[model samples]
Target: MQPYFMPYLGYFQLARSCDQFVFLDDVNFIRRGFINRNRILLDGKPFAFSLPVIRASQNRPINRHSFAGAMELFLEQLRHTYRRAPFYGPVFRLVESLCLEPDMNVARKAAASVAAVFAYLGLPLNYSFASSHPAEGLGGECRILDICRRFDATAYHNAPGGRHLYDVAAFRAAGVCLRFVKGSFPAYGQPGAETFVPGLSIIDVLMNNAPERVSRMLDDYVLEHA
Candidate 1:
């Protein structure tokens, strides 16, 4: 999976479902995707928050992009937006540290957020970026296969959304098992909202629930063999 900007709960669930997780950062970035943006709660509704990327393009890899925005405003917005949240104090500090970090590389910054969340909850972050090992010129399932081979992995777990894109027989031929992880965001209380908004950034989750609660929610997923 590509590095996302503090993605939804299911993103963490997908990572938890696997023994090893790799971010496909070397692949071409997707515009209007979660690469540099995510939804958050504001005004009792889902508000999209995005990190402005310098010359972000679909042609370039995610790791090639750098953030180009006012870090202070972003942090302030988060502070003001979630001030009433129950766990906002600690959650804001975590998000503040991530946003205020000197490293502006979008992929690294986003991965740092994910890593920070796991670290906050005392969970092991057993993951790496695909660019760490070059499987240059390979894309799609071929690139995934190359990654699995590089890691000597026996199984490949993907989000349910891409279940149609893979060929189970091909993975079997390579001596690997392919499965799709199905996950749903277990609804939690969001201040001032009657209808729970699902799929908001993990920041929302952290702000609304305790770290221990969020850690338990990570296991809300099932794996289906392909």
Candidate 2:
């Protein structure tokens, strides 16, 4: 549940369905993963927006992609790209404030920017980064179960992708119920689209509509079980 590149509405839908959400920042980043890039519709076409990360050593993990000297340029690029969008004025200022803050840690800056976006959209879920947790040798179901235990969560909810990776029966044995979130398309205000495109990055919604309207769009998303 990392704060990926302005994730789609389904991410927030799953977040609202859960009691507490964990940002899995300590995990390795897959090179082609959604960690630093996402797609959006622009000028009636799909385009990818991405952030550049410092290349890591061969032994270093993908999640270790760190911000290098190019951070200032990256922020400028985002401002330039988003400046003309509907809510870009306030959003750019907020992101710039965090990005340009003197001596701020890279991860903190990223997380703060994510929090700011969610705040503007009125999402109320609480968040914590995995790096802040105590060291433990847990992965797969055990890792999720541990979070549930710590928070006294009766159910552990995950995105649909976890079905192949997690054991539902094992979690039930440990007194935690496992639930997978099934995503549905939610309507949004987009320019010149005959049919709604689902799963475009959250920025698509933000740039096309106001904050209040975005909140209402999020409220309209329906969740189903697999």
Highest lDDT: give the candidate number. 1
Q: Report the lDDT tens digits of candidate 2 across residue range 76-157.
A: 6555556677777776666566556663333555556567677887778688877666447886567767777877877777
Looking at model 1, residue 6 earns an lDDT score of: 91
Q: All candidates' lDDT scores? A: 0.87, 0.66
Model 2 error, position 76 (Å): 6.4
- Cα displacement (Å) at residue 219, model 2: 3.0
| Alpha carbon lDDT at 148, candidate 2 | 74
- The collision pairs in model 2 are 28-63, 29-62, 29-63
lDDT of 1 by residue, 58-134 (tens): 98888898998567866877877799999989989899888888899888988888889999999987999999979
Q: In model 1, where is the ten-residue run with the lowest total lDDT? A: 69-78
Q: Which stretches of candidate 2 lie over 4 Å from their true place?
A: 57-64, 69-84, 98-107, 192-196, 222-226
